[model samples]
Target: MAIQIGFETLVEDLPGPRWQALFARLWPGYRAWFLRSGAVARPSYLESRRALRQHMPELVPTWQRLVELAGGGDVEARFLSLWCPPPYIVGCSQAVWIDPAGKEEPALLRNYDFAPALLEGSWLATRWQGQRVAAMGDCIWGALDGQNEAGVAASLSFGGSTVSGTGFGIPLVLRYVLEIAQSTAEAVALLQRVPVSMPYSITVLDRRADWATVFVGPDRPAEVTRRKAVTNFQHRIEWPEHARATHAAERLERLQKQVDGPGTLEDAIGALLQPPLYQSAYLRGYGTLYGVAYRPASGRMELLWPGVRWPQTLATFAEGRRDIVYTPGAEAPPDPDDAALAQLLTESRS
Candidate 1:
């Protein structure tokens, strides 16, 4: 049998009925994952809120409104804060390319690789914190990747490490950066102060073609580098098994070679759709579901799947849905939420 994955687009300037419906749809599955390790394993609502205030004060008001919309439950608030939640990881690759053709602005490219069932698949355009932001949403409100109206785009790839500590999840951190930062330097500065539960490499690109990859983790300080092409590791491979399984070294080498030389944005997008970077290990929880190209300078972004392209802009975003059909039964990995996610998708279709 074929499994179909659904994606939806939602536009709201602030929290309201539309956002409430989204929470109603996604919270059940996310709640299962959040409590997988038991409620005690996660932080208390007070602790979670406190951490958010200390590290990202600007998000507090929006977080409060979203929590209220979710019925103001304790678990809902804690999970939405994304503070030191259960550990999870993804296999992804990202890069910054200043297309030589000049047909478009400098672009940020990303391939989000993970289990199909687990992807929240919500495309959102919102001005929650004053600045307009367009992003692929995860965990209800957190951003998996996104760009702001200021022409700043940011994407993240998991840093190859098995470490987890006292910090927020990367998704919300990405959301925070896109919410407030206006430049690559500003984004890097934002990453430096916030702790991340796991190591992640975030590539931030601005309209001026300025970009940098910041490596952040709860255990250490954030490190910024000029590397344009980033895969799932920093400095060295900390998780050999994951690195080998995800072909981390191979993917990084391939991306590095491509970005090091001059190329058009068209060629760069084509390169990501090819081998090593465009993964297909869906069964293993590391398949490339979609490739996205962000032209921050032009305020445009394109979502790619083989030949199909769905383009959107902050100024003109249409709410819709796209269902991707996939063959089921990949040797289900140990990802805790895969089973819950599968059920969620199944129910949504019915």
Candidate 2:
């Protein structure tokens, strides 16, 4: 049996209603769970939205709807993941399977079981929000990575050394970056200013194409600048002895070598989706759960996942596998019912 993968592409203009509808169908249990958890506090959601509006006023209404869903706790965890876009470009792997065989009609539809509820609960507890910002870990239904409208992306790996005293977990920060930033530089600026207390690596890719990896641990903050790509582990020039011995860094280095020459978006995706460099327990431990590719030029994005176990590389599904083909200038409507997000304000007050 192999892991299952799902894909979705949301245009800037698609009516919010459409997304709400799709969300209802895909993750029916989200709303009930959200209400039961009490994770949707009024002030938190309001603050998150206010912060977000400061950067993109157009998102005000959407943030409100998110708030409403939060109050009833009816907002399902999976729906939370699907609702917002990642703050920056991100990609990662996981160790679970929906279906070992690829014969299912929808491919990865059954794979949702791999991520259980404990992960979902942890994600909600770690969620972050301010007047104009909001984000959560284990978003998209407990997937190990995600971001917010702020332009930040958080991908995770089970590396060595586990330190505690959580400031703001990496996924929540990723969500915050996306909610507040209009570009990559702004995201980096936010990281530098904030005080974090976890040991994790976050790769932020801004809309302007500037990329940076911030390594947060119990000691100091180390950062690496990137242009073409970023992977797990340390990649910054500022860090000397910080690099770990995990396969994550080695795979990223190997891919960097292969792309020494000019490459297309497809080439980059290929390199990212390929297997890890040195085969070991880490390879299977941190297998890719999914891959997120962002094209700032067109405001377009793609989420790729390994369709089968072996031989076939991951497939890109931004708008249907064969729909956009990762080209430039691809356009879609921003979801409108998302406007109902404003309604969340009223619901939260109640």
lDDT over C-alpha atoms for residue 103 of model 2:
28
Tens digits of per-residue lDDT for model 2, 1-350: 33223333332232244434444454434444334335542124344344345533544454456434443343332234232321111223221111123321111100011121112221121222332222122433232443344333434432123343324334444555565666557766766654343444555544343455556554566454452333444434232121232244565555555445344444445655555632222111222343444433233333454442211111221222211111112223323542332232123111
Task: Give the alpha carbon lDDT tens digit for every residue of 168-195 in model 1.
Answer: 9899999999999989899999999999
What ranges in model 2 sit over 4 Å off?
A: 5-68, 71-137, 140-160, 222-230, 235-246, 277-285, 306-350
- The backbone clash count of each candidate, in order, is 0, 64
- For residue 34, model 1's alpha carbon misses the true position, in angstroms, by 0.9
